[model samples]
Target: MTLDPLAALAGLGFGLSLIVAIGAQNAFVLRQGLLRRHVLAVVVVCAASDAVLILLGIAGAGVVFAAIPWLTTAVRIAGAAFLLGYAVLAARRAVRPRALEAGDPQASPGLAATVLACLALTWLNPHVYLDTVVLLGSVANTHGDSRWLFGAGAAVGSVLWFTALGYGARLLQPVFARPAAWRILDAVIAVVMAGIAVSLLLGL
Candidate 1:
């Protein structure tokens, strides 16, 4: 069967939008990227982890959302709340930008420790599941038979994003050292999250 371009595009757009945010997982990836410590391994783990979770959401989580319509509404409402709260944090960070603490590459932990920390940050966090399994899953299911295509798009996005972030972080070091850079980034995040939250609530 031919894949629906619209469905795939929708998935890619939504997946990138959802994943490109200030979160524990992204922060870890950013830090690892900056340090240049196990960059390939870290990137692979994150992208692979996201692919697995996306499958769970697209294949199974959507089923749960289907069985309970009320839960879907609740999850949407909760997602809105999550987005708004994320916006608040981003706004606060923009007001008080943090200093770059990438530290010495020589002092970075061993590969095992680094991988374990990355795993902990990604899997142990509840927010990951919310974003991927619940929110993305529900939205993908709405696409009907094209949902897997949507999921595939999302997986592709995850791979692309992690690869870019991991590989491109070195280029950002000089600029990111300035607090002003973080302030601008946080401000953009705030606006994006707030707009998304407001739109989600309006849809409900």
Candidate 2:
């Protein structure tokens, strides 16, 4: 099948626009990237999960999700709880900040725990479903037969964004070398997490 370049570009742009926002997932990714703690695993999970979700959306999972409102409601409750818990953790980290030094064995979490947290941050968040499955799916459908191409483009966009965010974060290593920087970042992450949690609880 011939891919539509225009459709692909449009998908790329749209996907980046959505994922680049200062949301819970991005905040978690940024923190992990800055810490260089299991950065590769985290980036792969996020980007791959997004690709799968966007494809599902393009495949009409949005309609199925809408038809079963209860599923979303259940996920919403779980997501809110998870976000709130994460916010508290971030708040504690902010209150007692640690410098994000690479290879600092004491400061970094194990790979299993980090991967689990990353998965939770990705899958447990309802906005992911809304954005990728529902919203992106709806938009892709507008392209008619070219919708799959749009989805493919979006998948590419996800890969690029996550790769950049994860790897490009190394450039900020100098700044995060200071404990003060870590404190500030954790505080911001706490606020973002709490705000998202409240929004989920309020059904926003």
Candidate 3:
């Protein structure tokens, strides 16, 4: 089947719209980018994971998920719990904010730990599956024969977003250099995380 450029662009726009929100995943990526700690690994993991999930969604995983309603319920419960826990941690960070320094030995986590954390942040959240696999996939399928092209576009959007977020954050280094900035950032992240968790619990 021939690829449709317009369908691809539509997919790209839709994908970006979904991912450009402020959430735990984006918050973590921004923090890592600011700290310049395992930025490449984090970006790669997030982007690659999103690509896989989006493709799965396009391939009709959404139908599979729908068939097993109990699975989504279980995932929602676990995801809500995890988000709330992370929210508390973010709140703690806000209470004791730290500056983002380039070479702070104490501030930097090991590469393996950072990558694992990134993966957890990406995969453990049920919203990721809903957005990428279900919503995006459903959207792509609407394009008929161009669905794969649409999926490819969405994957490209994920890659572009992660790359920009992971690298573009450095431009804000001067702003994040202060402890107060970190405090504000963490506070925002905490609120966002908590809000999402609450929404999940309420089935929103």
Candidate 4:
């Protein structure tokens, strides 16, 4: 039941490894950061969502995910499809450079919507379950009763990372203001998303 420092460190490292990858959540965070629009809100939603999932994983949700083979397969297919769709959308945005709507200096996605979006992005994706719940949880297995501490460490890491990424991206806002820069970024996102989708589909 005691907190094992080694297990906590392993869990923290594993959590960070899975999160640092580029994905829809990262893309959204970067956009919000660069626009200085809802940056804090995005971070709160993302971090809290991760905390919940990480806890669930520590509580053996990974076993549930693994138990249902068909469900896992469905999630994989769905996640791949969503990635491809998002890729197409990104490519369209790149081709048709449209002016972004004036960000409401005060307007923001409602708390409910923000929470829902975060949960959907974090939970609905099979990759999240596979990486955080399964992979990271497996690392905490040695902690036995102290698995909660491991999950806590992982949650703390998620909070730290999201905050850094959200705010760090704002530093590049001035450079991204250029229309060409936006186009290029969109193109890059499209390519990345497409590549991820292909990788998932091929089970790579």
Candidate 5:
């Protein structure tokens, strides 16, 4: 289908607004980057998953997502709990420093596992559904004949953002390899996750 510039721009703007936020998914990506884990796999998985969701949104399937009130609430609760647990784990990691020796890349996470993890992180979050599929799609649908253009723009935005997040964080790997830096980063992640959990609980 032919793409419309105005619709594409609108979708691009919407995608940026929602995806640029620092949240659980971003934290996960940053963690993977810090550990120097399956970087390419993680980026591909996240970007591809976002493309699919944006397409689904453009296809008018957003209503289905909106209809699942209970499911969304359940996901939100689960996400909050997971974040809190992760925060505790991060706090522990911060307190106990691990050896800085790099492990064999081959022994780390595989492509399939990385993809699955990213998919679960993206799909299991109620916020993703509401922001990308429901709210963003609703706005794009108002474009009438240019709806698919909006989806394409959103898909592109996802690719750009995920690549930047997954790869860009790697720039700090050299610094983070130091035991002290690792502790600080871990502590920051813990605080961010805990704050997010509280925010979710307060419905903020």
Candidate 6:
């Protein structure tokens, strides 16, 4: 299992491409980042989850996943339900938008609750398995003995993305301070969550 720079670089690019989408997980991270509450915990949970999934894929768990289609179906249904619930919450927030108040203790959830939400967003999403475990695994294994190196690179990409999304979101604080801005953001989140949930259900 020799370390290969080319394989690692390819894995990095592939990993970034897959995760750079506007998904439920990204949305949650961005929101937490903007709120500046439990950002580090959320980032850690998301990045660590991605790393584990990528490594699992490289370790040939993708084969097991593929062999058991029913498992993914069950996950998909559960994810869709979770997404729908989040969508409703987002829609409710959109209906009653509030400006960002950094000093407001009630504005953000507690750390434990935040961590739980982050875990749910990361793990309950069935697409995560397809992207990280199945697809990334297939691609990394093609690197032969350098597959572990590729997995490492992909894991790094995940960490980088979540860190950026979670910490860098503070940069948008000025804009999001406006209640209208939050209204728009929540509206968008509602749509994205509902759309993804519907797609998941349809696929199942």
Question: In TM-score terms, which candidate is top?
Answer: 6
Model 3: CA > 4 A from native: 97-103
lDDT of 2 by residue, 1-204 (tens): 555669988999999988999998888788888877788898899999999999899889999878998889889899999989999988887776343344457555789988898899888899999999999999999998789888888999999998899888989999887888887888898899999989988993
Candidate 4 least-lDDT 10 residues: 99-108
lDDT of 2: 0.87
By lDDT: ranked, best first: 6, 2, 3, 1, 5, 4
Q: Would you list the C-alpha lDDT of every candidate in the order shown?
A: 0.76, 0.87, 0.86, 0.74, 0.75, 0.88
**TM per candidate:** 0.66, 0.94, 0.91, 0.84, 0.83, 0.95
Clashes of 6: 0
Off by over 4 Å in 1: 1-3, 62-106, 175-204
Better of 3 and 6 by TM-score: 6
Q: lDDT: which candidate is best?
A: 6
Clashing pairs in 4: none
Task: Choose 1 or 6, whichever is better by lDDT.
Answer: 6
The model with the greater TM-score, 4 or 6, is 6
lDDT string, candidate 6, 1-204, tens digits: 466788888888999999999999999999889888999899889989999999899999989978999999999999999999999988887775343354456556899998988898888898999999999999999999999889888989999999999999999999987878877888898999999999999997
Question: How many clashing residue pairs appear in each of the predictions shown?
Answer: 0, 0, 0, 0, 0, 0
Reference-based lDDT, residue 60, model 2: 91
- Candidate 3 lDDT, tens digit per residue, 79-149? 78888987898787778534334455655579998887788778878889889999999999989999988
- Give the range of the ten consecutive residues with the poorest summed lDDT in model 2: 97-106
lDDT of 1 by residue, 1-204 (tens): 455779988989999999897665676577578667799999999999998989999877746755877765665576667667656866776775242234534335789987886776566444577789888988988888899999999999999999999889889989867767766766776786677567657766
**Per-residue lDDT value at 52 in model 4:** 78
The TM-score-based order of candidates, best leading, equals 6, 2, 3, 4, 5, 1
